[model samples]
Target: MRRFILIFLIVILCTFPAFAQENYCKDKEPWKEWDKLVQKYPHNMDIQMLHAVRIGFCKKIEDSTITFEVASDAFNHLHETVYKKDMAVKVREVLDEARDSV
Candidate 1:
């Protein structure tokens, strides 16, 4: 029983950050634009992953209010993920157009 309680507490602690991150940049300007892009290009894995990357970036910074400039910086500086060159270029172009509307 004691071990079960401890495990439950540990699980809750581990999940707290996920919940915190979920709300970090949701429903904001760039993300709203991102959502539309995601819907428009549902088959584009690059766009989907880029959305995840931006959300992860926002979570890493613990910032809820993300602007286009901040997202652009994150998108440009990502070093860990390798994407298909042309698709990545297209995604960035679409992102830039979205920024204009925001």
Candidate 2:
């Protein structure tokens, strides 16, 4: 009976969404992927800009589309959070200027 209960709890936890709004950037791959995209086209500000926009887009939307914010806070640079491994979505207002330099 104990074993059955443990299994049931595990299954229930698994059913929940892996990515939650508060901590979506648990995986840094998305931000890393964006960086790689920037490296590919050094002069292509357009593509880089798009990538930044995507990060910010992921943050603004409340729906469970993308997990994480671009997090540009001093404590959390680029896609990092101040005290956590998670990344924050990029804020859209300065996306263009930031990407232009990245």
Candidate 3:
């Protein structure tokens, strides 16, 4: 039983990214950009697609010009096959709404 539990934990830990628990761009300001996008767009589908990979966007939040470019790279890395689209969409929506208040 102990061996089985150890194996299960090892598998689980290896499957999940070490930084998965934290925001993608911990140093960058996720809320700052999230607010701008939400207030101007307000649930726009195009923005939905944009937000689906927000971690990439978050990375460039420090600079306005780099946001889109870095976000593009982030999208490619997302590898939807590994990360579910619905989860990304939901994460984006929640973050956007949470930051919209600003």
| Top-lDDT structure, candidate number | 1
TM-score per prediction, in order, is: 0.42, 0.30, 0.28
Please give, for residues 1-102, the per-residue lDDT of candidate 2 as tens digits.
323333433442343244333553444865685577577566754445545655665555445553344332311332222112211122443576788889
Instruction: Give one digit per residue, the lDDT tens place, for model 3 in 14-101.
Output: 5435435454465355456545665666655444454555644654664665654445445545534333444465588889999997
RMSD, each candidate, Å? 18.5, 19.7, 17.4
- lDDT values, one for every candidate: 0.56, 0.43, 0.50
- Among these predicted structures, which one has the highest TM-score? 1
lDDT of 1 by residue, 34-87 (tens): 678678667766566767886776776565466545654555544123333544
At residue 102, candidate 2 shows an lDDT of 92
Order of the predicted models by lDDT, top scorer first: 1, 3, 2
Model 1 residue 84 lDDT?
A: 37
